[model samples]
Target: MAGVISGHPLDTLRIRLQQPSSSSSFSALKVLRSMASSEGPLALYKGMSAPLASVAFQNAVVFQVYAVLSRAFDSRNGRDPPSYKSVVLGGVGTGALQSLILCPVELIKIQLQLQKQASRGLGPMGLIRRIMEREGVKGMYRGLAVTALRDAPAHGVYFWTYEYTREHLHPGCRQCEENTTTTLTLGKMLVAGGVAGVASWVCCYPLDVLKSRLQGEPAAYTGILHCFRKSVREEGPAVLWRGLGTAVARAFVVNGAIFSAYEVALRCLSSYQGGQSPSPAAE
Candidate 1:
């Protein structure tokens, strides 16, 4: 929740800048200034409710699924620490499962964030009702296919990088051992999570841009391939990375907070449970 709140402004700008008709000259700072001056400072937090409401549920599902799959893979391989291949497969499973819940939540969030005028004050529930009335249940999942495509490989990279970084950063530390609820310093957790977040985004940002475009109103492109081709042909390849600056910044802050919080919570819970800590490793 804290991470989402901290990074939402950047996400709003990223979504806007990914739009087909968005100006090429728009920077994150420029977008921030424009939104503040034209609307209000609070405008940056538009569409925050949906994400805040769903983030816990979303993360719970992803981590649980990833852990289960990773354990299964490790058992099959008869390995104590799972191979990179197993980690990637677990991540893919996590992403695929999470997408089913994320699609509708994101569809609502993108719509609310992209709204320019206060006159069109459609809250999340209102927008959901409107989508259902106009386009049926499927409308809520406007970009599920692209979302799955983006998330699968992105999460594969995300979890793999996080685990790989944790092991290297804290070499020989029992805390870094798999299936241990060992507490890590906040700094270590931040570094690992930050790298994971940035790697995930950098690897799959273009797909995200396309997914946003397909979900947003006044849809310009027909499908994923058409969106890619049209964007490159008309706007050039640079357009695909329009909001990368803000995204990277957000990744570092939000993911750092996420991992730190996860570690802290696990440690506290373990301490509370008569010093019997469960493994903090998602795997």
Candidate 2:
């Protein structure tokens, strides 16, 4: 929730910038200015409710799924240091499972965010009702396959990067996996999480562009490959990389905050489990 709240403005910008309609006139600066000026600053967070409502639960699912899959894939079950391969595989499973719940939430978010005027004043439930009215339940899952494709390998790379970076950052430590008792320097944790986010976003932004298009403009394109070819043919290859800057920037901040919070939460949970409490600074 903290990460999502902090990053949503940039996310809104990134989504707008990724759309097919974002022409030469719609640079990041211009989009930001236009939205703020016309719709008020709050427009920057137009679609945040959907994600905000679900992010804690979503992240819970992500970490839980990743932990389970990691142990399943690793012979040592994280008794020994975990392998990068197992980490990636675990991430893949986590992301695939995440997509099942995420697809509809994101579909609603895209619709709500893409609305031109806040004067329309459509909340998440209203948007969902509109979607159901127009296309029914199947419409809610518009970008499931694309979201899975984008997320699976991206999340694989994501967890692998985090694990690799976090491990090397404190090579002397045994490193914490499920053990919430172990802690690393907060700064290093932030770096690992931020870099992991950047790696994931950069690795699969093209698929994300395709997803936004599919979900945002359902009638515009048929399927993933068709959408890709059409976007490339019409907008050139650079289209796929549109909003890459905004996303990368947002990813760094958002994931950094997320991991930091995650660590803090773990310590809190551990403390409640009759383990050592975090220091004042950590608290």
Candidate 3:
């Protein structure tokens, strides 16, 4: 929630920037300032409800699916610690599953975010109902394929980078010392998650730009490939990375919070269930 709120302004700007437009001189900061001046400061958080409401479920599905798949793969290979392949597979599975849920959530969110830009005068629910009335259930899932395309590799890199960073940062875990503490410190958690977040976005940002365009307005592009080709052809190659700066910035803070909070919660729950105090290494 904190991450979303913190990065929403940039996200809003990114969405507007990604919208198919003949005008190629769109600047992030200029767009942001224009939004603030024309619409109130609160305009930045126009579609926040969709994400805030769905984030918990979305994250739960992604992490749970990833964890289950990863564990299963590890057990199958008789590997105590899963290989990078297993981790990537798990991440892909997570992305695939999460994309199913994310499609509608993102549709609603993007529609709301781009409501002003698209000049759609409807609230979130109204927009949802309108889409349903006009395009049926499938309408809500405007860009599921591209979403999955972006997410699969993005999450693969996400988990891979996170695991790599965690393992390297706390080499003690590799030794498997009986008396060694395996607690994740706040600093380590932030660093690993932040790096993972940046790596994931940097790896898949172009796909994300395409996904956003597809989801934002279907009329702009015929299909995913069409959108890709048109984006490159019309806007030049730089258009593919329109909002990358804000995206990477947002990913760092959001993923950092996600991992840190998840780790803290897991440790707290384990300690409570086991009737034991928190580990000394978990500061």
Candidate 4:
């Protein structure tokens, strides 16, 4: 869960940058520096608990479901192994399902991070109460549509690119090549994960922008379509790319670490389950 833990702080910063009006009335960089100065390095990590929980649960479920669905697709199709299409579909399904499950926790995390003194005077508890009282249980899923749309395709890119990279990098596919080994080399994993990150970001950026706006400042956006039209009309086309640099950087770091960790973890788990010594090639 290093990704879930370390990444939320950046997630908080991304949210802050995307919705500058939600925080102080300063430029994005200035507000970020101000928060660092005022609240110490730790301040950037507000509302981290929910993400930790969410990511831990999300990764577990996504990985498990992806494996199961991909294998099932392969078995049903009578292919020797699953095709890349199966992997993409599995990733998409896992992402959509996880987004639906994690939306409430995600909404609370964003609301906690974004609530300004002048806006609503709502603390975390107050925000939760207000949402529950006014919008009912469904209010916690405010940005779920955008999240699912973004994640399904984004994850499809991730899985497809990841497998494609591994397949290409390996010498042969018959014996589960070195690239697919549990102890996959750091360099290959980094390259694969980095490419996947770019693939995901490029394909899903518009949806991500919509999700960020919806989560960080709901009032600023009536809905996804309205947000898109208003953004295009008012802020020029570049509005959809707000905070893209930071997002790219965040994705590079976070997704790289996530992929590496996931591969390493899966190797360990698989070895453990098989009652075998850890593969030296894996480490």
Candidate 4 per-residue lDDT over residues 88-166, each given as its tens digit: 9888887888888778887888777765533544555677898999999888899988899988888888889878876
lDDT: which is higher, 1 or 4?
A: 1
lDDT score for residue 53 of model 3: 87
Per-model TM-score versus the true fold: 0.90, 0.92, 0.93, 0.85
Q: Which candidate ranks first by lDDT, i.e. highest?
A: 2
lDDT of candidate 1 at residue 39, scale 0 to 100: 85
Off by over 4 Å in 4: 20-28, 37-40, 75-79, 117-126, 173-183, 280-283
Q: lDDT scores for all predictions?
A: 0.83, 0.86, 0.82, 0.73
What candidate 3 gets wrong by more than 4 Å, as runs, is 75-79, 117-120, 174-180, 279-281
Sort by lDDT, best first: 2, 1, 3, 4
What clash pairs does model 4 have?
183-282
Superposition error at 169 for model 1 (Å): 0.7
Among all windows of 10 consecutive residues in model 4, the one with the lowest summed lDDT is: 174-183
Cα error, candidate 2, residue 32 (Å): 0.8
The alpha-carbon lDDT assigned to residue 114 of candidate 1 equals 88
